[model samples]
Target: MRPFPLLLVLLASASLSAADVTPPKGETPPPATDLLGNPTDVPTVSKEEAAVLVVQGKEAMIESNDNPRRSVDAAVAFSKALKYYETTGDTDTICDLEANIFWCKKRMNLDDVKSFVAQKSGDKTVVAALAKVDKVANKEVTADKADEYFSRAEKFASKNPENFEQISVRYFEVAERFVGTEVGIKAQKLSLVAQQNQMKAIKEAQDAQRETLFSKPTKLNGKIQQTAVPSTDTQKSSASSIRTLYKSDFAKRKPNQKQNLLNKLMDQARTTKDDPVMLHALLTAATDLAMECQDFYAVISASDLMAMNFSGVDATAQKKTAFGKSKNPTVLAIIKLLDNPEDGDANTIVGKYFCYEAQKWDLGIPLLMHGTDADMKSLGDMEQLKPDGVAQQIELGDKWYDIGKKGRKGQPTLEGPMGRALYWYQLAEPKITGISKDRIAKRMDEIDSLLPMTNLNYESLTAKQWDRLKGGMAVISAAKDRNDIGLRLTAGKKYRIVPHPTDTWQPTTYYSSGNSRSVNWKGESLTNTPNTRQFIYFTGGDFKEGAMVMQIENGKWMKPGLVEGDGRLWLGPFSDYAWGAGGKGEIRIKILPADDE
Candidate 1:
């Protein structure tokens, strides 16, 4: 999940009154215009009329949640109130009213009352809309043509087997042009294979050069010398020798002997250079001995040194090479932790190694929180000074949630700070009741939404297609030429829609307040409610208000999903309230045919 900007949230929820629209005493207001300073023919109203309209809009908006039909009334009232503010040249109130009008229209389709009714009674319009989209999305590609295209690429690859770079590019082009077809999928896979082969060839060439250089005889100090390159066997032998020099059975050794050995390992680490395997062995021994002796600082020192020396090195391969096939519990746990930090048992063991054995509270807490062991959990609870009362527990949960929301410092852990917050919330869940329970549950839901989803994969594409997906096509404003993608979508086809990371725009310049306060493709919600629901009453009812909305050949607006029917594609920010006017910036979107279709 992406971070929500606090300033946008504040702006969305803020309210304005008639007083905000009134000019200061003895000050002349500017001429009527929109928030962007464009000239407008806003008819003036009496102060009494403006105040009454504001009150009516507020009342209607408040009642609309319970009776969604009242949203139309609320929208009308806010629109009139906005005109009055516009006449007074009050930019702040005009901006507030514009946003309120947007919320009113949004609620007309998304309020719980209306949504429940639609669900129970079946909305014909929704069914029709979906059917229309599906009709276009399900359109089949010309299989024979796609096959012919793919065959040519395959023949090219067969002819130029050693030209992996050219072969990959050919396959990638076929994959991109005929995406969503079986031949396209095959082409994409082959493209990946060709790229991999190319990389392997490059690596092999580099390795051969290194071998020739190392084995070559060179003159040094008036004498010819042959340099021996380190091999797998040589590295293993060096590591073994270093271990033998430092290793001692902790159970058989006295405290002074263990300390002496630890000191010797540290001294070796300080002097060690030009030999990574020896350094790894020395640090690994020091870490294990430090844990055995319950020395927090020493364990941290060893771990830190190991990480510094092995930056960018494949950690799993390095550990496996250093401690090959070791069955020692500590060694196994370290390997498992490195391979999969989220493994509960591995986390528990490592947690104990840090919290109990080494007494490094900061490093151990996150692991213990993620671990399944009851004793370790209790230890973690004690480390945090867990309170007994339900109220206190909720407070603690909130505290952690806030910390996680703000994010953590230093190297990121697997469970993450949000996971830690979730740990506390889960603990408080069963203990609370009524509104408190509901609040906790809501918070937990938010955290769940915010937490990263594992194993989520998108449709496979070639490197060129992947680049296009990430690069995105820009949709600037609501103009036909700017928003249209020129490609027609079929009814039965599924497409993945992703907002470009850097593409942001304000639906109205009023929200900018003379700064670059633009929002992402996912627009800000002006209400307390989650801005994730579709506004089915509008053209883009398939997407939430403020999100990037699309239309099929100027038909009903929809978001990323299976095409309902065939039509030309058009994309833009959701700006129905402004009637697709007065917005700054552009929205870039990536459209790809989903493999599931």
Candidate 2:
């Protein structure tokens, strides 16, 4: 007879809150927005005015250092100060402002600070800020009653080793309370050991009881005869085999070990007449191994088994009970096990399979993005996809779009989570090539059209409103025809203009003083001539190329009527290509976000 009915126990006890790993929450930061939560636009300021704003912003930042609650106000002040100082390229001042902003954002528990720093890549100021936050995050926190907890655990394990349930709970408490620390990690391992030992003891006891009952002989008919009893040795073996499969170290094993083990599991499950206990265990073990190994084929094979045996979650009490008797009684146990903390690669494996093969977008996004970001940073290059980074990004982008589309269909809210799709697409665009590049580019435009853009009162705005418009805001010309109206400002400020991709250009052909017939300025010295009217020109580089519209900023001048009189200029900071003509209706401009490139 099998030694005893094997009791396989899978324990998941340690968990960390999302907040633990997030940005700082220093003291108490100021509010994210004004009391009404509405942002005001920042208007163009003179050099003197800009200086005054910077000084005032610095004062607020100084005050914020002592009172964390003032961080929000400091952030706001620094942001506005940046809007002015950026025009002058004040490197020192800009660094100070960015640092303050990062600190405040961290203290507020905002994640965007990291994203902002990530965009800058090599900027020393933002990089230092990021380092500071990381240092704080890694700093040790004093655990309350850590020794007491450990003592209690020792006492419990020694006194009630047979009480597996209570023992597991105590160990789990210790593990959870001290996660990320040396003591906590050790406790977690010990908890697993305790659970396994207790389970083995129970199985042995049951086996002994069965043997005693079976060993008793019964007399039959005239002659005394021994009883022939059926054996459950096969069932016991199946359970034991599954446990061994889960615990085996894949790294030291032969390449064929996976296939061999899978075949063995299948044979055992089949020989047992597809018993739920054996089959479920087979599925769970395969999944855990597949994730641990980061083996694509194994993952696929395991997925097939999961579908064939478990199928999906049970909805009824009766069905739930039936599944509970199986090796992985609950679906959660299988998933939770696959998400092992020790295996850094498992998440990507799990995420990729879920998104691409299983079509589980909800579970795939967070893991996939996290893995992709980690890989990108570790690899140290924007275009580098040393492994599967690019592929994952592409797939993640597709899933995000699909999810966003679903959200839009379900509600009328502007925050349909659709923007995430575009965000991922943009991230993947620079890393991919060929057909994928074309596909992503086309999809980006299509999605942009679908998204709503906020049209600011560009004629007059506060620094707050301008900052808000930096990433996704736009402006439309109210006039039926193009007009010479645009942002008016003092000279010396530099601005990068970006015409809308689909905007209408007055002339279909490229223009120069030698070939300006379209604008009726042919034969005039428009190119490199002092007498010719100054103009804004656009051509070449990635993204749409054309002199679509003329914009006025910081006193710069453009040729008379190049656009169809739209009365507003659509522009972006850090555009790849564009040149502004100096003097005569000149407009000064500043690129906000300081041109990530």
Candidate 3:
């Protein structure tokens, strides 16, 4: 279980204990100043003598530095001196002695210092000082635990290098368990490196095994001989037989062995001339193996190959069976690799899945929408390539919109259903025409209306506020080049400005999503050339350098744009404060809100 609240624990630990005293047992004695009007047990020591005791205790404490045994002696001296000071009624000296004793206990066992101080006094100043000590002690414990976990993870990896999954999981656990510590951060980075190396080793070992199997001398007619020339027919025959290649022993093999067999099949496919069925099968198996291997780059290559070929081939009965066995692996592998790639045409495979599989719209729509003009031309007629892609979007939108209406009655979770419905509807708008377009637009607007409103007039917004406006809107001033016009945001919000109608944003096309039209400082539409918004639209400052927008806060500047969302470049949460920046443009900020939002 998590630890108790810090403040509560400290407060409880700092409470003072009861005073120590002894009562007479077996006899009752009563006297008023011993019948002589004098207080019993009053100290007769002079003020000078008490002062000397305090000086001696101070000397002892100063000498105890870095000497824990000596610290105990100092505590003893302070305890003895405390009585003298108490008799003299020098409260400051008494308090000083109590604090010295606490320090002595800390030097012996820092963890016990809190309890020791609490037993002595309930002085807030003493408790406050002890709290700082407690923090350092707690930090020390955390650091030790983090280091121990890190060491264990390292030793486990070293002792069991073959257990990549287990080792990586353990390392990641250390990273997460001690999240903010130096050891945890190092463990996190080391875990990533370990994963990368494991993947590389797997790839290298596979290559070596392939060389051993395929590079050997061929045995022909009982005579072993190396062939200098490659056989084209042999390659073709290998491609034709891939379906039956591993069928005999396939079910008996382990995952890694299965991976090796699939690798051989892929190798055969690579060497053979174009055979659509074999290519599709190989692509399917490659994707499955890549997923299992957690080889992200391989998934990207496989997805690219499938997208460029799968649509052109008619599936054979065997191919259909293989595809069925693959369980639509391309969709999953593509989703994993989508954000990692900088350039690729994933439209064909993504569109096919979007059409037939009826999954992956969260991933597929962005790939299609962000396609360059070349990508669009590559599709010929989008309808011919996949009719159901558009239909699926509409179907999903309707389904989710119904869920929005029915699920949770009224709650934030409504966004899950309605936002998804709007997402599909909006994605389909640009691809379809006429009533279809109008229908999508209408549904999107209706969903948007029901969604929550974000008040952006504030200089900065929190992550929750940012999430509320995702696939929604912000009410703010019109586009202008002034600090007052910009939003103060952090990396977590990661908002980027774009032109409202542009379908995307760039540093060269920065503007507010809140108000599209150029307006005066009050945000009222300004009198200017009708298309003046486009000319005055803010473009090219820091965003062109990379960030989509620059923030200016209190005469300081910061930039946001660390990660990509759907098609938009969004910034991550800031590590430090980001000041707002001012720019004028007709462009507006648009974010491809995360699905979980």
Candidate 4:
């Protein structure tokens, strides 16, 4: 089940950073965009990801338990499956057997993991993994019992670092100490030992997984993927330039629908002053649904637009990735909005929405940007102010400007949520009012001019076309042009929910619960299915990370625009064979929430 913001309980075996992971130099494109274009940048898998691997008694992986051919699906199968032995137990390691299988599958397959596991049992790596899984599988250790065991184990382990078997024995002894020596011994020693033995019974599981499960790289099929990174920071940046990594064209997307949706959400919020906690949670969830952002509209609109829908938003923009441009469709959408930025509605919800934001964000921007001529003029030019107000203004102005700068920069490396909140806050008022007519016109022209070079559509597609049906039915949704067959998918769909094969060689995933073993049509079930109805699914996308984009920031380029006028891409799709990318079997995972995450 989905939890509140940043409160996810389990660990996601996040794919590595997409930065270093780019399209293979000489690969061809498949049905989807190249690795770089797919927005499915793998979540950063921290060392914390290892925590989910050691679930209760059983090993977790991406596959279901019922698959006789579990090997094929083992890599994505739960992470715990690889912890089938004592060697890895209690080590807090990433070396789950399933993890090894996943890596091998990506490179070689389960065969590699099996062979790897076959190494001498005494191998330090193997032993640590066994130990880690043992602890996760245990569900009954009480607090009192746990504490008792903790002290004993700590004493024993600290004294004997070299003696693992002794440490292992002590670990269990302490654990069992909680339920009284007898019960603890039975659970820790007998039950755990038995569980460990059971895991090993399937000795060939790793090998089989390696053979059937293979990870395809995310290569751009036949497109000229001239990969480059933002070597250094430049002075100026904009929304479009910020999120340039995915190679999208947001302008062609339909507009009014966005406004309509945002309008609808604001209505609901005012009508029902719901409980703030639940409301906040609901709001976050609702906002997430609207993540299918093309530009800025999706960003701010999401907050006010969905109070009416229980359906949960599916395609709005993400605020986390909001600031400058790339992951944030809002900024781009917002800039598009600011084009004719004067006069917001005094009565209508939309008017008030922007008004509210402008009031908030503007409070900071002009204060910082305009500067104080003196307090007396009061920002109209201003007059002298008391020293205290001056100090306060400076502090306040700094606060707002910092946020404003972040919004412009797109991605600020600075820490703290206040900075983030303020970034959004500064834009609330002002509503780009100070953006003179010349700047607005110039901004529009500059944004639109790049559209042709990208050779992509900016219009939103109708929902009729982008039906995201479940099952093997992938969104066979077509792009605006052939060259962009999979390149740019407008925010809205134009087609009905058609059944396209979701399981492509490109990154594909299965949505199921209950160990994945229970509900998977493929006949596998995940073990710990959250009780709440949740979308446990995955997708085929490029698993690359840390890639940079050609963007400008604060009048300079945060990264070079080498790819900005990357003249060659305009010719069309990766399949063109015009550039280095386009190859087959080069796709990774792109997971979409049954709703939106």
Q: Which candidate should be chosen as best, given lDDT against the real structure?
A: 1
**Model 3 spans with C-alpha error above 4 angstroms:** 1-298, 302-350, 354-442, 445-538, 541-548, 551-597
Residue 150 in candidate 4, Cα distance off native in Å = 1.7
lDDT of 2 by residue, 212-328 (tens): 111223222232221222136754676566676656533336544654565555555444432565665665565455444444334444444344444342213322232333342
- Which residues of candidate 2, in runs, are more than 4 Å off? 1-389, 408-415, 454-498, 501-597
CA RMSD per model (angstroms): 25.6, 27.6, 28.5, 26.6
Per-residue C-alpha lDDT of model 1 across residues 413-462, encoded as one tens digit per residue? 32254455565655555456678778887777676665543212222211
TM-score-based ranking, best first?
1, 3, 4, 2
lDDT of 1: 0.52
CA displacement after TM-score superposition, residue 8 of candidate 2 (Å)? 41
Candidate 3 per-residue lDDT over residues 1-597, each given as its tens digit: 101110100122332221111113553232123222222322223444445444544444444432333443444445444545655666545444554444444444433343444443543323332332222223323456677667777887788887554455456656655778888888878777766666666566544322211122222222222122224574455444654666653553465455556566556555544455555556666656655554433454455444444443222222233234344455442443243332334443443343223333433443444334353333323312232245655766676687677645345346545655665565455456557767776777677666655312112322233444444343221222222332444444434332233222122222232223333221222232111111123323332221223333433333432222222222211111231233233333334333111
lDDT of 2 at 343: 34
Best model number under TM-score? 1
lDDT tens readout by residue for model 4, 1-597 = 101111101123332221112223563211232232212211222222333332321221212222222322233323323322323354323323422332222222333334434442323332233222222333245655555555555555567554333344344434333555554554355434433443453334432322200011122224222222221232123222423522332222444344334334334433544333333333343343344423223344443333233224222223324333353332443333333222122112222222223323222222222222232113212211111122233334344334333443222222221232232222221223344434433433332322221111112211221232222222211121111112222333221212111112111222222223122111112132121112333312221111111111112211111122211111111111111122122111111222110
- Model 4 residue 183 lDDT score: 43
* 447 Cα displacement, candidate 4 (Å): 28
lDDT of candidate 4 vs native? 0.28
TM-score of each: 0.26, 0.19, 0.22, 0.22
Candidate 1 least-lDDT 10 residues: 1-10
